[model samples]
Target: MHVEEVFVKARFFRALVVAVSALASSAGFAGEVQVAVAANFTAPVQAIAADFEKDTGNKVVASFGATGQFYAQIKNGAPFEVFLAADDSTPAKLETEGMTVRGSRFTYATGALALWSAKDGYVDSNGDVLKKNEFTHLAIANPKTAPYGLAATQALDKLGLAQAVAPKIVEGQNISQAQQFIATGNAELGFVALSQIYKNGKITSGSAWIVPASLHEPIKQDAVILNKGKDNPVAKQFIDYLKGPKAAAVIKSYGYQL
Candidate 1:
């Protein structure tokens, strides 16, 4: 090869190498973050995680369950990098226990309680079905571990139906299972997160009376980075993405308030 041609090739090769390095650095090596998500926020988190993975070229490994269970798991050193809790208190409790990153906790969504049934027109809009007491069984999460379950009991208490409805109650370990009971006809009707059966400004299927927020305590969903995720950049990115406009739109579509 001619000397001039050799020089030109060397320069071009160096430029190519530099360009590749820059591209790789900008994109980074695709990393994955393990996230523990609350059961009620399942749909919204799945939607948001899809967008997050698409936009950032990262993977979100999410496990959905009740917030209190997740809290216990985290305390026992579950390998979760982030937590999306159904209520603000679990994250706060984790923060206090040094299980999470400091100042990383924030409310992600405000959930609504819903009285839902898989059968069409089975649940009245005003939630008179609870008062009517006509169903063979009613489903609720175990109030001891699920915030939605606590909210359900609170609403029952407010309506003076706690004792009357206690006998026929069937309990699920988590809100998702409680919903499954209704969906699979294991129970005629149940209390579930509004987001579970709601979408695009309405219930997705069956009948639901959106339990008035005034009937129970506000369901403030929160998120935080766990100690396991303290050094993971993707953990912060996921939370930041959730706090952005795109994720907020998805959350709202599922009947959650930001």
Candidate 2:
């Protein structure tokens, strides 16, 4: 080849190599963050994840389940970069146990409970349906593993119906499942996250009584960066994103308090 042609080819090859390297770097920083989210926060988290992806070019892979289950999975090294728990205690425990990045836990949202029935007119604003004791079954999350479930139990006890309604109570593995029981007619009525039955500050479907927050302790949903994600920039970004205005707006719209 002519000397001039050889020089031109060398310059072009170097440019091509630099371009490829730049693209690879971008792809590396835009990698996915694995997140474990409590079932009750599923809808709001999904919305936040979508917006985060669009804005930052980073991806989020979320697993929705009971917070206790996620805690177990994380202890077993489940590769989750972050955990969004339905209660504050779980994340604090993880932090104390060195399972999460130190000082990384924070309350992301405060969830509300509601007494809901798929059948129209079955539930009232005051939750008198529980006192009437007419429903064949009531669904609630398993109090052992789900914060919402614990809250449901508290509310029932506060209403003086815990013992009276024991036989008719059906337990779901998670809040999502409890909601499903009510949705699919497996249970005539149930206590669920207000977020599950409400959107835009209103109940979208079904009859519901917004459970008074006074009925139980605050369901302070917490988020933390797991130990495996301490060094992950994207995971840190995601945790920060959860505390930002964008995510807070979505959480509020879903009937949660930021």
Model 1, runs deviating above 4 Å: 1-28
Where does candidate 2 stray beyond 4 Å? 1-28
| lDDT of model number 2 | 0.93
Model 1: how far residue 72 lies from native, Å: 1.0
Q: Tell me each candidate's TM-score.
A: 0.90, 0.91
lDDT of 1: 0.93
Task: Give the Cα error of residue 208 in candidate 2, in Å.
Answer: 0.5
What lDDT is reached at residue 100 by model 1? 85
Over the stretch 164-228, how does candidate 2's per-residue lDDT look in tens digits? 99999999999999999999999999999999988897898999998899999999998999989
Cα RMSDs of all predictions?
A: 3.8, 3.0
Candidate 1 per-residue lDDT, tens place, 96-209, comes to 888889989999999999999999999998999999998999999989889999999999999999999999999999999999999999999999999999889988999999
